[model samples]
Target: MSNKCKTAISVIGIVLSIALLAISAVLAEEAIIRPALAVTFTVISAILVFVAIFYAAKIDYETGVYECRKCGHTFKPTFKAYTLGAHTLSTRHLKCSGCGEKSWCKRKNRRV
Candidate 1:
């Protein structure tokens, strides 16, 4: 998966876990100490930490078929990203690598 997707998922997981923990704690009455409650809290906290580590970082670039303004020849550019250990994501960018020209579809397929 892309770094953007990982980051998005991690943020969501953290938010939901915290919210659930807060709600459960507030619902407690008379400060009852229960073994199950402690277990539940531990589980949630662990999940939150795991997600935070997984997301880590993200990088991306794009490439695409383009008409070289100077040479009038079709060219291509490729996008790439690095994140999550050795994982990577890449796709064609809408720009020419040969002559640095812009393609028509430069706006499409933006990485999440």
Candidate 2:
């Protein structure tokens, strides 16, 4: 899939999750819905958030490469490392395959 499409899907998923949570909160606050139903909606929204995160992570791993600061090498990390390592919006703490040093590596999306 294209990067833009992937990004759009991820954003939509997160937005939908947030909207559901807000709806649940409003329903519970106004007593418009049963408390049990509101609780169910909250749980579903939480699950959706998790699912969206997982999908985004998987896409990142598959469609992007991380550039190591130490050796300037670009490589894909193992899924385990990708998940376990600390990260920011644009970088991840990872061990460079070229230099065997850990650093915050910049993520670059690979051109399709």
For TM-score, the strongest prediction is: 2
| lDDT by residue (tens digit), candidate 1, 16-66 | 767766655654543565757866775776676565544332122221133
Stretches of model 1 off by over 4 angstroms after superposition: 30-112
lDDT of candidate 1?
0.46
- Poorly placed runs, candidate 2 (over 4 Å): none
- CA lDDT of each prediction against the hidden true structure: 0.46, 0.90
TM-score, cand. 2 vs. native: 0.92
Model 2: lDDT to the true structure = 0.90
**TM-score, candidate number 1:** 0.33
Q: Write one digit per residue (lDDT tens) for candidate 2, span 23-102.
A: 88999999999999989989999898889878877877888899999889998899999999999989999999889899
